[model samples]
Target: MTFVTKIRLQSGNRPALDRIVDEIRSTAERKGAELRGPHSAPPERLSVPQYKSTAGDEHRQFRSWDYTVYTREMEIVGHNELARQVTEFDFPDGVHVEAELKQVEQMA
Candidate 1:
């Protein structure tokens, strides 16, 4: 059987985020896991205060990210460690991080 883990991390620090992405990729490789998606794909969401707006109406911007990682059931490890490191890792000024983890099992 194969298993996968979906991880979501939020960091105001862009440099830290960049480094962790690489570290996670390396960790997954050492643990014989497959990581999908981009190392850093930035998606911005635009929202306006009023539902109806005309031309030249400015809106708020929100940023989010998406990533997919794969790993075998028995060979899985260090996800929490990475998350911990990410949380505590220091970066340039005005930076912070939050992480979320989800485990999934493939149906046989």
Candidate 2:
């Protein structure tokens, strides 16, 4: 049986996101882990409406705050140690991480 760890990272800060991804990539390279990629996804543009007061008034609303979120995804293949390390990484504030583990059984 083989396991695959899929890691997805998203943040509004591009530099910080890239830095973490680079760190993971370097560590995998040094440890000779089979890493799929740090593939980048298109920036997601989002907006939030600002309200001056809790009352629902159209005139009391402010301009929408717009932001872009960047995402990077990678997969660790058959290296449980490396995958665990990545999942347990101490990511800084504002960076969001999601990890999923899947078991793959070879057809014999």
Candidate 3:
């Protein structure tokens, strides 16, 4: 039996996210976890602005901006133990985290 652990991390602190993702990947590989794509979601959408055309405006266009981000995913062979390990995974300061466990298989 196996389970896939989906880890959702929030935006902000790009460098920290990069380092953490790399570390997690390395650790998971060393531990023989069959992991899939981290599948990093797009940056956090923070602001959107709209302005009417002005006489001297260089350009007239609405704009939207977002903060960049990173995402990581890991596989778990032993559901319980892996869940515990995931909980203990190092998270950068001020970063938000959420996890969802999907059952991939069931062993008799």
Candidate 4:
């Protein structure tokens, strides 16, 4: 049996997101754990309209906020403890990480 840990990282700040991914990659390397990748996904763009008042000011019609969320995914193979360590790492502000573990059976 093997456990595959899938890690997903997201943040509106690209620099912060890259930094966290680098840290995780380096840590896994240092621990001699097999890491699949830091595969990047297309950035997700989001926009929200802003209104200062219920009546809606003249400027509010064109007022909106836009942000891009960058994402990266990686797999940690057969290392539950290492996966835990990576998941428990203290990441700086503006970065978010999620991890999922799944069991896989070996084929004969």
Q: Highest lDDT, which number? A: 2
Q: Which stretches of candidate 2 lie over 4 Å from their true place?
A: none
C-alpha lDDT values of all predictions: 0.45, 0.94, 0.64, 0.90
lDDT of 2 by residue, 2-99 (tens): 99999999999999999999999999999999999889999999999988998867789999999999999999999899999988889989999999
Over 26-98, each residue of candidate 3 has an lDDT whose tens digit, in order, gives 7667777765656676665556455556553537656655454555454444445655676688787956778
Candidate 1 lDDT over residue span 1-108, tens digit each: 333344444455555555655665676677555555433445334333442335533463233343332211112333555445434645444433334455565566
Model 4 over residues 1-108: C-alpha lDDT tens digits?
999999999999999888888988998999999999899999999998878777868575755889999999999999789999989898888888888999999999
Rank order by lDDT, top first? 2, 4, 3, 1
Note the clash tally of each candidate: 0, 0, 0, 0
Best-first order by TM-score: 2, 4, 3, 1
Report residue 81 deviation for candidate 1 (angstroms). 10
Q: How close is candidate 1 to the true structure, as a TM-score?
A: 0.40
Candidate 3 global lDDT: 0.64
Residue 4 miss distance in model 1 (angstroms): 1.4
Q: How close is every model to the real structure, measured as TM-score?
A: 0.40, 0.95, 0.63, 0.90
Model 2: what TM-score?
A: 0.95
